[model samples]
Target chain A: MHIPSWLLTFCEYLEQTASLVVLLPLGLAFWRWPRLPKTMRLMTVYLVFTELVLLASSLVELYRPAWSYGIWHFFTLVQTLLFFRIYYLTLSSPAVRLLIQFAAVGFTVFAFLDSLYLEGLQQVNSYTHVAQSALLIGLALLYFEQLLNELHITRLEQDPLFLVSTAVVLYFSGTVLLYVFVNKLSAPADYASHQVIYTLNSMVNLVQYLLFALAFWYAGRTLPSQSRP
Target chain B: MNSWLLPVMLATPVLLLLALGIVGFVLRYQRRLLRQQEQLRQVRDASQQQALEAALLAQEDERRRIAADLHDGVGTTLAIAKLHLSTLGQPNLTEEATALLDQAIGEVRRISRNLLPAALQKFGLPFALDALARTVPADGPTHVIIEQRGQPRRLDPKRELIVFRVVQELLGNGLRHAHAETIEVSVDFGPDYLSLQYRDNGVGFDPAAGDLPPAPGTRSGLGLTNLRSRVAVLHGTLRHDSAPGAGSKVWISFPIPYLPADQKPALTTSV
Candidate 1:
């Protein structure tokens, strides 16, 4: 496939910048640490962990390129667990929380299987990524249903969990396709596929971080939350 | 094998647009739901206000009936008894008995007037308020001072009654509970509003506690709650300024609708 060099450069810059945009939310979360609710605090922890993982993975890539994929495989599992914790805290239904607890255990087992047997550490684990996207997207839908059932939230825009769930749905659903074909298409010589993956994923990732920053900023401004969870 | 690079590139923007579209839809739908909720709340509030207004009107009607009965039936009967006693010319009938009969008649008249202020109905709020202040004896421990500002104009009889009741309660609470020494009431009539300021050198309370010192013994008598209801019906704003040991001051402002000159019939009076 013939791809424009300018587009490739833009995609590369966007990819590098998108990951660091998590700092916006991270700074806000820290600044408003005392005021944030349990869910928002948990999200802050995820943000911190993500930044750490990004830094660690970059270092590993420079030192040992072969093991870089292993770091992301670990990241996939941790990210799922953190999100489960976040949603579990916000969702009011006891049955849903229990279902999520079970889902957490189930996803952990699947992630292990994918790493050891299905897609090995050297591969992109497109199956795991697709599954993660589907599961998270499902959780986001459940959250939306919960919001509808409980209209207690007077200001939906300021609600931290609402903002976070939106980011989750958009980011996961946006990047699910990229994840699905990334393994097969990421051959060393397939420059066009790399551009497609980096460009699409980075754009959505930037949006996710910006939304996250807004959520954190709102949480900081209002101390006594109207949201039940 | 077909290269999916072209398809992926094309589909990615479409997917992003789809996600953006979903977010937009959710926002619009939620706002619509919220607007519906707000509209329902407004309807509920309006219904409640109507119910409250009806209850207050019924209470006033009842008061008027009771006052009429007391004055016409009870007072008249008492006066006839005094007349018959005087005509009997009995030796056993002492002067004390005659004096006590006069006091009883006076008491009945006072109670009847208290139930429904005929002065307020006949004259206006300012006149009724002045009459109320005069009820506080000059020799009494508490000295009442009434001040009026701007041109005096008559309001709707029902509205005057509401304002009268509010002032009546304030004075009653201060006299009965606080044992105020000097009470000052200032009434300001703006071009389109009426404001009242009441200050009493009484045992003031912490306004922050949001509690009134109980003035018991008057059942069906308008208390602070009823006072607030009356103010609400008038669409008036009330504020309190006081602390423990300091004198309490209350400021009330009620918007008065402008009645044009052609609409003016028995509306203006001397203060």
Candidate 2:
């Protein structure tokens, strides 16, 4: 395939820019440090972890490019754990919280197994991405159900957890398919030519971060809400 | 474009739209549930108010019947017996018997009046309240003062009874429980509202702890429950402030329905 150089450069810049965009939300999360609730504080931790992972991955890519996959494999598992904790705090149902616990355990084991045996550390972890998307999307659906059942949050848009859930649902659903074909897309022959494909992940990353920024902003200000029993 | 790329592009929007559609449906469904919950609350309140009104009206009817029995049936019989005793020939014996009869008649009259305030039906709430105050011992430890303000127009008959009962209960409570030295009761007839204020300098119970009414199944609890029901039925507001050592103050206001000037009564001001 004769991929254009300009097009390839554009995709590279876009991906790098998307990677760095985590700073915007990280800054907002720090600005509202004192008032962030437990769930939001967890989210801030997730943001910080993401930025660190991205930086370290880049550093490792320079000296030992193959080891970068291991860092990402670890990132995938931790991100799911954090999201599970966030949902656990916001949700009221004992049954759902129990489900989250079970799912968290199940996902941890699956992700490790997939990295060690199924996908290996050499290739993109498409299996882990797909599984993470499915799990988070399911959690997001449960959260939306919680919102309806509780009827406590009068303003859905202003609720930080709700915004975060919406973002999770949007990002995961929008990018799941692209991730499914990622291994084939990243084949060595087509890796340089098919840089445009990864741009989809960047676009969704943009949406996800903006939503997170909004979530952090709302967390800083006190909005009318009731504590879930 | 590769065969896999075409399917990914086509399916991504469908999946995104599916998620969006679910979110939108939830938003709409939640709003509807909220609306339904609000309507259910309003309905519950309305039915509760109606039940209270019916019970109160039935209570008043029973009181009226008992008063009539005391005044017409028992009181008349006692008076006739007193008249016959005075006709006895022995002067000393007649005098003693006649005095005892007089005491009996007076006690019956007092009981009858308490059961049903004739002044309340004939005169109005202010006259009835005045009569209520005079029933308390003037030289006793508790001294009650009644003050009426604004142009005292007549209210609905049932409303007048409620106002009178509220004052009666307050006075009764002051004498029985409050142990106050001075109790002041004020009624204001505003242009569109009727306000009642009662203040007592006594060993007050804590309103914050809900000791004024106490808990259910107690006498005070029943009294407060009844008082609250009456106030709620009229769509009125009730406020009570008190502490262990500090005095007690209660303020109640109701939206008044005014009567024409020609319908006003010409009752004397005497307590």
Candidate 3:
């Protein structure tokens, strides 16, 4: 099925500009409330890395198309590590922490190997994307379970960690199928389908960033602390 | 399995593991919370017990002070007044004035004895109870009987006074409220504990209804509240057996700590 040209153009515009709109307030919130949990502060740093990579990749896509894949691959590697670190800090169980650590190390090694020998820097790193999405979805579900088990939470909407976990679960679940089928759909004949599928990805990205912004706003209202274990 | 089903199978186990992990975490967390709450309750109960003990001790000290004031301050003055009246020569004194002064002295002595029974400190609990039984006038409609079992042994003086006061209060309640004809007081000494029993043929009220006097500010059950508190202070139990139209029986027992050979009392056979 074909998407309307006007709506597609609008989605593209939102994809490009959503981060700036979301990040400005989120940055201000972090600046206003410096006592956010150590994990959240680290997440702010990861967000800065994401924005920088996005801008660099956009510029490279316009001028040097060949290098954009390399840039994207590198950013994926870093983002996976940062996501693992965030979960490691938030979770208290040693077994889960160990599982995440093993997954992070295994993914890093696999990505290194796939980039060098198989996909190289020119192809989409679909393997790493699929693995990362699946891992994140699982972690997000675990986080929700933990939150529910807590004896009390004053307001779930105001809980920054709850918002962050929701964003992760929603975005990763939305992209799991697209990442799994990326290689099959990369042929030039499938260009229109690719554009439509990626537009969905962009829309998911917009929601994810908005959720992050809301989480930061909640964080600004109070010091970031874990709910009862 | 279909090619598409491969990821589904892999993801299924991962999701299950995550759920199991969280359930385990919650169970451990809840157990920890229960233990903390249990510890908090025990601490609160211990502090409350300590406060009750302090209040009981303070009450006994205050009673001793008031009793001394009545005996030394009031009793001495009334005795002096009686002596002065006698000193007036027989020719100068009127029959009416002499009888009035004698009656005034007797009333003062009675009040002083009620405040703090001097017999409780001088002798032991059995002796004090006997003296109390004698106070119910023999001519009155009510008959008083005193009974003792096992060799009588002296307890700690303070404890003896507490037991005496409890009995005295019971007797007073019987005379004032219970229109009974027979009041029997008995003390039994065992190897490890002592028991005091009071049975009266009074118009017994319902124990369930708590017919005792109301405390000053609160409408708590029967006047046994004070008796209950004293018994608690002694680490003892107070049981009341009564029903409407049936005579009331109160039984109180206190554990006796082992006394040193030097502190043990010489045996006494009679009440």
Best by lDDT: 2
Q: What is model 3's native contact fraction?
A: 0.00
Per-residue lDDT tens digits for candidate 3, residues B17-39, read 55445445544554566457558
State the lDDT of candidate 3 residue by residue for A56-132, as single tens digits: 99899899998988998899899889989988888777999999999999999988987887778878888888888
* Winning model by DockQ: 2
Model 3 Cα shift for residue B122 (angstroms): 2.3
Clashing pairs in 2: none
lDDT, ranked from best to worst: 2, 1, 3
Give lDDT for model 3: 0.72
Clashes of each: 0, 0, 2
Judged by DockQ cut-offs, is candidate 3 incorrect, acceptable, medium or high?
incorrect
| lDDT per residue (tens digit) for residues B87-166 in model 1 | 88873764677788899899989999999988887777889989999999999999988888987677876778888888
Model 1 chain A: worst 10 consecutive residues (lDDT sum)? A220-229
Lowest lDDT block of 10, candidate 3 chain A: A220-229
Best candidate, TM-score? 1
What does candidate 2's lDDT look like per residue over B86-150, in tens digits?
Answer: 67767687887778878988988998899888888788887788788888879998889999999
What candidate 1 gets wrong by more than 4 Å, as runs, is: A223-229, B89-97, B206-222, B258-271
